[model samples]
Target: MSQPSPQPDRAAGHNPRSSGPGRLIIALYAVFVVGSLSRAGFQIATRFQEAPLAYTLSALAGVIYVVAAISLALPGPRAWWVSLAAISTELVGVLAVGLWSTLDPAAFPDATVWSGFGRGYLYIPLVLPVVGLWWLWSTRPGTVQD
Candidate 1:
């Protein structure tokens, strides 16, 4: 029996982009992707008519989470841009939905991932974008990444 030896990183002086906080951020995004997808899938399957807006928004959020997670996991400039775009959109969605939910509670009728800034998810949705952005900026600059 034998184990594979460690391979050298492509970057000469750069650390792995998915190291440290990036790992945490990626893990969180993965959890949200699963959670939002499950919730939206169930709602859409059994009770979409009850709250189409909320359910659809949940599904959209899940897609965004999946994109962000994948972008962060990959190593390239395209992935970087995709990650930024996804996270930025997520921030906007959370803020808009949170404000709307506050101003017009009846409008929601049911909770989405971004409702009340993700209150049901312990407000991680509200903070994730900022953390993700920071991780992106802190990582080394290049086409190959993560």
Candidate 2:
């Protein structure tokens, strides 16, 4: 008679690799995803014609945030790569839009998610992408893989 094999520890819902900061990051990303998407929906539905460029940009940012959030929540190398790409694009978008809005207020006329470095959101939009990129890099294969 052989002894039974021990089941893998699954005490918490969280994966072993996704404790602490990783979970926190994921939660924040989820919040941003929802916020961006909701804002974009409102902007596009209510007054898209008023500032087409800004509204379009808002929509794009929302999509990117959603993708990044989902990718980060998933567990795999592919997800990591996708999240990295999304976050990098987000960083570039925020920087470019922030500078453009600052240099020429008339150009915006209406604010996008990246306008003024996301001042409306207290610059979290600007900083989030940087943190996300770092997190993804840290979780890369051959690294911690979290």
Candidate 3:
């Protein structure tokens, strides 16, 4: 009697995308989302009048981080696109805010998430997006060899 053929192994099992270092990246992004969203919400609700621009930027950063975390957790072309968009936005925000604050410190009398290149957040804001892009590129479909 012929034996039944074994089932094909799923790519998910060894998907280097969300395994190993990728998992740590996702966790870090998630933590940032929580912290940023909470801080932004509190600042906007209670002290938006104090610094509208700073509060708005904080809100935007929180949203970008949320998107980044979600996209990193999922595996697909759409997720990859979302990750790229979010990370790109993050990089832009950090650079723009960093430059604007440096040139005219008075513009940001109050600190935003991207202020001083995330000096308030240990500069993770500056480095996280670059690392995120690297993760996405390394884990592109069929790019990770067994």
Candidate 4:
């Protein structure tokens, strides 16, 4: 009789087994999720009138970050695609907004998370998406694959 191939063990629920860089990526994502959401909420509530466009973009960025974080944390193929899409969109958004802000300061009297490549936030907003994409790519099946 032929022996059966062993099945890969998956973590319970959305949680993945914390090992190597997975744990670090999850931690960073969680922090960004909270940070983006908090900044967006504060901006929208306090001085949204000052820069409606910037504030709205901040909120949108927050939503994207939250979705990416959740999807990355989850264990499954669906989560991978979700995270990839969110991260890619985020990268594009930051780049476009950053360039626009640089070219036309008048358009954005106030700053956004993506302004100047997230200069106020120490460029984490700019770098986060790159890291996210790399992490997702690394975790793809056949490679590290999370």
Clashing pairs in 1: none
lDDT of each: 0.86, 0.80, 0.86, 0.80
For every candidate structure, what is the RMSD over all alpha carbons to the true structure, in angstroms?
5.7, 4.2, 3.3, 3.2
Rank list by TM-score: 3, 1, 2, 4
lDDT of 4 by residue, 1-146 (tens): 99988645564443342346667766776777687778778888998889989989888888887888778777777788888898899999999999999999999989888999999889888887888787777777445533
lDDT of 2 by residue, 13-118 (tens): 3242245566777787778778878888898899888888888888898888888877877766667788889899999999999999999988888998899999
Off by over 4 Å in 1: 1-15, 140-146
Task: Mark the regions of model 4 whose C-alpha exceeds 4 Å error after superposition.
Answer: 1-7, 11-18
Using lDDT as the measure, the top candidate is 1
Residue lDDT tens for model 3, 22-136: 8999998999999888998999999899999998999899999999988887766677788889999999999999889888889897998899999999999999988988988
Clashing pairs in 2: none
The true-structure Cα RMSD of candidate 1 reads 5.7
| lDDT assessment of candidate 2 | 0.80
Q: After superposition, how far is residue 48 of candidate 3 from its true place, in Å?
A: 0.5
Cα lDDT tens digits, model 1, 14-66, are 34557777888999999999999998999999999988999999999999999
The TM-score leader among the candidates is 3
Please give the distance, in angstroms, between residue 71's alpha carbon in candidate 3 and its true position after superposition: 0.5
Off by over 4 Å in 3: 1-15
Q: Estimated TM-score per prediction?
A: 0.86, 0.84, 0.88, 0.84
